[model samples]
Target: EITGLDDKDTVFRTVPSDDYQGRALARTLKEKGYDKVAVAYINNDYGTGLANAFKAEFEAQGGEIAGFAAHEDGKASYRSNLAELSSGGADTLVIFDYGDGTGLTILRQALENGFFEKFVGGDGMKSDAPINELGAENLATFVASSPVGEKSDSLDIFNDAYKAAGGDPDAIFVTTSYDAAFLLALAVEKAGGDKAGVSAALREISNGEGEAILPGEWEKAKKLIAAGTAIDYKGAAGDHNFDAAGDVPGTYALFEVGADGFEVMVEMK
Candidate 1:
């Protein structure tokens, strides 16, 4: 029996990874010619880390970080922070929070204070609940950048496998989580069921070597893996190549809430 071990040297990732997501968002905002940006992130590991990465990248690209704010999760009020952001005179706002409920709260408060502008969000802020909560009218000018799940070739196969496993393939996080599980399982299988071996196998597969078993051109990668090839796995989140910082490179899609719900503005690959 393998007991779960948390080793400092052994890094385990649970999702699409934040570094890529952060960079993608920064790049998209810069490309849109937004010189001044503000960040309001949740006070958590994921939120703070992503915000910092976004700030670093945005500033590096000759962009200005207008303001940075932090909100604790489960807090009821963001009026103070929103007021600060409004006073900052930022044209673009990047929110690194989660769920539609929180988003609605922030949006509602911001709108009430007349802080209307081009609002952007991270993956966690991509949800229909916010639109439903604040009503489409309130969110008309809001946009969010999230990992493109449907755009991933692996997601197509992961959807099939998820259905085969009696799961809902349409649920965004569920399918991606399923893909993560399958990736781990495949790595374990290739490692002969050794946990350490599995980790190594994952690194190998992620580095672009291994039998692409999930979907798309993964099969072609099998030869490379057999030949000890280092390959990057373009996952369900789009372009999940592990970077030197142990972060997976992914892509994001810009979405806006319109009368018809969330509509895709552009794919930031």
Candidate 2:
């Protein structure tokens, strides 16, 4: 908390690390029986983090890294990059990029190159932009990994309540946003106010201690807090038990890119 030079403690993220997500992707590829794979990633922090993580785990899992490519975002063309990377002649590619804009373009261009057999990716490919642009049926063989949490009614409740309130039920990461805000408020209440060093209190409140409170239980939580009881907040994004880094344990799911949306193939805790 005191010595981290990256983002200050003022910054807290609900999402899992790129490395964890990447490792999960690698494991999924192994389970799916991909032995050789190329890599294409966004040449940025997010992409690099996942790239390094996946590469390490993929190799450790006895998979070979055929080739790797880094492409800049907002590019309309990636034929040259894809060509150079696929020179390894891998039948499959571990592509890493947001599934929109340049990311979608890269996928389309990669298919045009026509050497790589299938694409494996992470959350960047979870977006619908690629499917919409390239046609889902054409990209049907794409595999992806995404950080996930255990299934809980809290999610179902949030989905229903969100849709009822005109929110997009399928929207990405909004649940994390909801959970973050709600958790912070709960911490403030538990701390008797937004006092100094409340972030420490924030960690305490969400650390799976005390009375269990699901989302939307503001009054109940207040009562628990008022009675000097500890509380665990099971949020819209499931049980968000923050760890020492203000991070939660990573979980993941393997999914297939589908015509309609991402179809979950398997989940890993």
TM-score of each: 0.76, 0.90
Report clashes for each candidate as comma-separated counts: 9, 1
Worst 10 residues of 2 by lDDT: 1-10
Model 2 C-alpha RMSD vs. true structure (Å) is: 2.4
TM-score, structure 2 vs. true: 0.90
Poorest 10 consecutive residues by lDDT, candidate 1:
1-10
Clashing pairs in 2: 91-117
For all the candidates, what are their Cα RMSDs to the real structure? 5.4, 2.4
lDDT of 1 by residue, 84-128 (tens): 876778866788987565656786777777764878888788787
Q: State each model's CA lDDT, in order.
A: 0.69, 0.78
What does the lDDT come to for candidate 2? 0.78
What is the RMSD, in Å, between candidate 1 and the native fold over all Cα? 5.4
